[model samples]
Target: MSEVEKRYLAAKERYAKIGVDTDEALKKLQEVKISMHCWQGDDVKGFLNPDGELTGGIMATGNYPGAAHTPEQLRSDLEKAFAMIPGKHKVNLHAIYVDTDEKVDLNTIEPKHFSKWVDWAKEQGLGLDFNPTFFSHPMFKDNYTLASPDKEVRDFWIEHGKRSRKIAEYFGKELGQTCINNFWMPDGMKDNPIDRLSPRKRLMEALDEIFEEKLDENYTQEAVESKLFGLGAEAYTVGSHEFYMGYGLTRDKLICLDAGHFHPTEFISNKLSSLALFSKGVMLHVSRPVRWDSDHVVLMDDELTEIGRELVRNDLLPITNIGLDFFDATINRIAAWVVGTRNTQKALLKAFLEPTDDLKKIELENDFTTRMVLTEELKDFPFGDIWNQFCELNGVPVGLDWLKEVREYEKNVLLNR
Candidate 1:
């Protein structure tokens, strides 16, 4: 037998000796809570009525609509959105963008708007989340990976990072909600190799700045306490893909793996989850993968079921929050809300039913081949069936037939590529 096969057999023997109960493992998985990153555009579906004065609302269909509003409009919209969500479904707000054409100014925009949202969230009991990127601006079109040798481009990126730190600090103090900065830089190419080292350096430098701001001595006197900052990176970006050796992997940051983002690259989602668990990050961005683009559609049967099982085995946090990172102009706002929420709920239920110990053992095993096989198995599980099984096991009422509805909606709405 080959060395890898021998290692796998040895690992399996060790696990067998310990003997995990699948039923008990499934129970533990059920305890994990799920949440979603809220966007203004997502609320326009018919489930919740739009407060006309506010930019968006939860529609009857259960999805939210993207609302690209001015600062003033955003404040009002957030107030309404918080009031609409049921206490059972956790709501995570997206990074506050300045405008459609520009990235939101953290210093100015977050302080005013974020403070307002915090107060409103407190009243409603909701959490906030954000994505960290400088891509929205025209200047960052070249890169925010921080490798630009050009002084002007580098300076712009630096300013953006500084803004992100200030914003994180403000949210930490005012909201007490952990600020999750999802860092996905449009800064690399598959063919052309750039100064690969600089991007990582720049990312670490920006993180250090944020850390320093949180530790600033001046903030000790504030009446309100700040939230701890958590950082998450997209599955793949410009330069090197996947977790590479020698790259400084800090414990402070969590790896945010998007399901749809990795499908085309053959980057194994379950293995990525294990790496994130090994490194220790807060949560994962659970969404469906398609083509090269993040279809951001609802969870597929095969994709998320496997991820959910792996999460349980690895003891990774399940959908601490969900991000419907999709763009669809055709679907009426109401349909979007229903679709997003339904898909998220379905995915979470399936993941919650997975055997936790099985996942945990796979994660703890030293054999790389066994881990790889486990990850592959997880990616192929029947997630939709698992979700139904979970609902039946828990004796909870399954409210909507979202898969059928979404299929119909996609036929009419999803734009041709």
Candidate 2:
């Protein structure tokens, strides 16, 4: 037998001895569908206007050459990124990425504005997710949208939210899969506000208006995301975690938990079980944080592994909506996508390799000492071998071979621009 076949057999025996079906684990891992963010390729600039500079708190650092400048280029770059990524996936888009002949006001945007995206996704056999762009416009210069005290501003953003939902419905109908429409606004004060309650009250009123006209839930899922702070919004975020969590539970909406948006010591793994208790599904934006809400590319770290473990052990994969939300312009954009996405899969696979059934039984029996030792010992198993077999089965490059492939793309395609 070949080397890969032999290694997989050996690893399979080891996993089987621990009560894990290696083949079943690999199959389940393949069933995971992660939505890759399109903003990463273009650094969140989208195609709103060629001259539109980065606004809001989100900014991708570095003068990386050949960042996508147009819709066609962005889609082309995504094709390359998707090729190296192992699993079939969806591409996340902000409304600003709409392909149109002229600047379309946010409130007036139609599904026609995104027809090209739908056509492309159909052609590529991928699904699409959407976000309402609440920043970078002149109206939001005060750092407010839905939560603004001004009635005119709130009404305009409410219309935009409605339009975004319509477009998400279109995506779902056209692609035959539900599209997740996420809404996040950068509304807060630089310093302590004298009237925080008023803004939040206005926000609730506006949201009530936004969701008053409901679309079919099967075609469109709405997610509300909260942030602790942004560049200027240091004192308080209008849509704090508490705010969205309560809103989500009360309204039966999905709540998004961004890893980088919480306190440094807080981890999402610990929150999964609690989240699963209420919401039908939770939206996860997997990004690494370095001290603050700095959306760094995700790595295969302990916290990430634990997040994966929680999902698998709790049987929450069916209810966990996973997506990547980091943009690092300093490196080759394609490589960043590959590394972040592949590392996420690696974490999930590591979780799959664990003998969770056995570990949990031991824990229930109150044999804490043995449980701890087995947990630690399982880490040194031939996980790498199993991972290599997974890549082989999926028809992707094994180990570090993809590094050379991405370098070639950078030289021939990325630097050409």
The candidate maximizing lDDT is 2
What's the residue-level lDDT of 377 in candidate 2?
81
Lowest lDDT sum, 10 consecutive residues, model 2, at 48-57
For candidate 2, give the lDDT: 0.88
The sequence of per-residue lDDT tens digits that candidate 2 reaches over residues 125-239 is 8999999999878778588899887888988999999999999999999999889988899899889989989999889888888998879977889999989898779898999
Residue 213 alpha-carbon offset, candidate 2, angstroms:
1.2
Query: Which candidate comes out best when scored by TM-score?
Result: 2
Off by over 4 Å in 1: 1-33, 40-91, 98-110, 189-239, 243-248, 263-268, 318-324, 354-398, 401-417
Report the C-alpha lDDT of model 1 over 150-217, residue by residue, as the tens digit: 65766565565556555555555665655555544455433344455666566545445444444442
Give me the displacement of residue 314 in model 1, in angstroms: 3.1
